[model samples]
Target chain A: MAAGAKLDPGKVRGEFPLLAGKRGKGRLVYLDSAATTQKPERVIAAEARFYRESNANVHRGLYDLAGRATEAYEGCRRRVAAFLGADPRGVVITRNATAALNLAALGSARLLGRGDEILVTVMEHHANLVPWIQVAKRTGAALKHIPLDRMGRLDLEALPGLLGPRTRIAALSAASNVLGTIPPLAEIARRAREAGALVVVDAAQAAGRLPLSFEKTGADLLAFSAHKCYGPMGLGFLVGKPEVLERLEPLETGGEMIEAVHMDRASWAEVPRRFEAGTPNVAAAAAFPPALDLLEEIGLDRVRRHEMELTEYALERLSSLEGLEILGPANPEERVGLVSFHDPLVHPHDLATFLDGEGVAVRAGHHCAQPLHRILGIPSSLRASFGIYTVKEDVDALVEGIGKARRYFQG
Target chain B: MNLDDLYRDVVMDHYKNPRGREPLERVDIHAEGANPSCGDEVGLDLQVEEGRILKVGVRGRGCAVSTASGSILAEMVEGLTLEEAGRVARRMKGALKGEVRPGEIDMGDLEALTGVRKFPVRIKCALLPWVTLLEALLEKEKET
Candidate 1:
């Protein structure tokens, strides 16, 4: 955390109250950031301060408090737009990444018909897959999956063949939650443009971990969640180019999205508000800026450096264990601070139970990516993900815990 | 929070070498259960003759607690009437929830699973087979 020094989680962990609990040194090692991140005390305090000092229902009241509340809510829109190098008017807030994907999918139904194609990558979380599947079912469009290579990376050569004349939309994840696979978006976006397909990116896993630029990625629409990025829960964003966002229709119809209201007929608001239908989560918006502050303080490049070191350390130690096979690329540079592995001799559920006794938390199960699990020919895998607060000792604890589980269960 | 409490020796033995794991050739009623939260699944087959359950075939893939619970249910339900099996299942469910003392009935090896009650998430793993067996009993008009 100091100038010209390595990241020290001993100092960084002090910012999180959960890690600062009754558990002593080496008693708890949380390795499940892919599921959800632990909130910092500052982010928690900002939300409490908003409710305690300035809290009001936004966009309806005409009082000074209402104006402050609206500014506090709209303030995050500007902050996020600036952070991602996007236009402020293009950001539409939602409950989570799934809501944003559903909104994008529902809007795409207008562009498709029978025989039309929706090209998607096979390395998607269900959040990115199910919505498009429902849209295909509704509009008679065919859902096409771009295949994966032997190492679980996207088969880039097949993209040209899959993106045909009728390819209306191309949906893909910026990074995979299960295999830790990160796709090359610029190349995919270039090919999608040749076939005239809209590119929708699910950045739920890649947002804060990587230095992301919406304009640079050439995506027409991008979505990400707040909770995964150390921001508050119950808030997410669906950002798009102004032209593309304007053409899409609102998924939910409610009070906040009206331009003019008649008993039987009503017009919609402008680009972003038309998509945001209901009353927004103002407290979470007020709390979100501090999370960005923490990310900026450490700097994304430093975060990347720290995570690469953590991943390499973890992959090396874990691969040395007998019968342990990692799911993704062996190189840490390809992954985004997470490693998923499986052992034939020990089930993930049983391993997770033993690890819990050692105070090491991990994710075990299909991770909401059942299709990927089925493709890999396994019921479940264990994931140990790192955050900015993760230190070398944490990875050592995980390796030790896994070694104990193998000895206890395999014998 | 002790691992020994949840992963007893008897539990691991059943997990390593499961019993009645092959699908039955003939069954009167069939039911399948899956814990989607953990992605564990199981299928049950009942061979009922007259009023008694002649056999319970178990097939599934999961952790020590789940496979052990299935193996225990498979061997424990043999030769009991469908009504008696259903009663035993309901009582076992109650016992895992810590709602009753399981000593009233002769639980046999099924008592090995009572420690699973301490882990709230794992209780589902220990109960999936028995619940599916109860479902099989109900489908053929056999319930207490």
Candidate 2:
């Protein structure tokens, strides 16, 4: 349905019931999709359907209910693999992006040796950054950084020096959660691979906003959360290459992942199951397919175009406002559909409160990238992000609310 | 979430022109407190003599509720006996938790931030500096 790309954002807003209503003094303008996306009714209905019609432990019982559950869960895995252009056998689902990233980090600890290095960037959200730090500490690997340039972009010029032979792994984010800066991952992945380092990309902010192909990016492992993509929470996935998957140790052990269990010892199941030990999030797994279906129906290329247009509009509007300093790249094309700004006259907390009074929702504080904020010389900032439902009116409302907040505080 | 209730004229004035936005030259106690969720931080420096606070100062970055409350706290604690300051800190905490009645603490400018009690999640912002000051005082007592 590529012809459906003609649908207007304002018209499609009705699909998300939360965006259809008014709050406080005006219509609710949700600009915090980077934090978590609003679930479509179909996605919510899918989860409820599984719980009501087919409720049973997957891969456990030989009965019809168990068979249905197993079929649905594994079917979603194939869908996710197809969506990412990855092999289904390599897809290991987890609780969320944090769990997925931790699985990659903790599971890949054996791959690193003493005096090796893990190259990272300062723009990573704690989920991506902290796990690598723990992995380095456990493996005697030194944690190194690809520092940001003057414009907050990753310093690719320094990549060659950082990705030397000692670099065992290079962990990077496809898009920064705070700055909205998308790194040149294909190039970075090439360098890491040439240096014989494994590449792990955190797609937490990039997955739904932009198109991603696991093979094309050349990442050995990738992690992303489903809740940020109009799906249910408590669901995320990590996909690794077959060879890399074979080397990863399972982070957890128990019920569902044992191949053969004596009273004393056991053998792990398969690649994905070995990593996923507990009872799977059966309903969540079944529900996640509808989100992919919706995205495919809308077409990801169209989604990216819609977001880029809005981001350009938002950047121009925010730039025209006095005292509002936008962070990240100067070009809207170089960033995602999110803008983090600092207003010299008003604190972010106060600005967010004032915006709430006007029925506008924006994220305040560090957005879990505290170190990035500190590097930018701000304690925290205000961020307004976009989704398929966002329209010109939302950005216009945010600009107006910001003007009011500045006036109220300065007066 | 009404802005008027949370940000009174007094609170805004203190925030815009904080009383003790600089560090004290010679202080007996010093401590730093941070609100990791919001990334608000405050550093408290106090010079105590015998059983009284001689001078107190606060400096750092944070929201209006926190910065204004911190400035007001510096003014209120100065020249007060350590015991009296402790009593005032307890009253402020009680008011923020909605456990104390009006006029119970007699905090003057500090009362402007009592509106934060309505927003339970933000009460920690208003309480950060005062709690940090108390921490310095307690540490000094332990040392002595």
Pick the lDDT winner. 2
Q: Give the per-residue lDDT digits (tens) of candidate 1, residues A1-411.
A: 567676677788899998777553355799999888889999999999899977998888999999989999999999889889999999999999899999999887888899999999877899999999999999999999988888878888887678899998999988889888888888898889789899999999888888889988878999999998898999999999988998887889988988999999999999899988878899999999899889888878888788889989998999888888899877778788899988787778888888888888999988988888878888889999988888889899999888888889878
Q: Which one is best on DockQ?
A: 2
Alpha carbon lDDT of residue A213, candidate 2? 93
Worst 10 residues of 1 chain A by lDDT: A19-28
Backbone clashes under 3 angstroms, per model:
0, 0
lDDT of each: 0.87, 0.88
Instruction: Give all TM-scores, in the order shown.
Output: 0.95, 0.97
Candidate 2 per-residue lDDT over residues A1-411, each given as its tens digit: 557455378766877878877777768999999999998888889999999999999998999999999998999889999999999998998999999999989998998889999999989999998999899989899998898999989998888778898988899999998899999999999989899899999998988888889998789999999999999999999988877988988889998888999999999998888888879898999999999888777888878888889889999999999768899998877888899999988889888888988889999999988778888888899999999899999999999999998888888
- Stretches of candidate 1 off by over 4 Å are A1-5, A24-26, B22-29, B99-104, B141-144
- Give the poorly placed runs of model 2, Cα more than 4 Å off: A1-7, B101-104
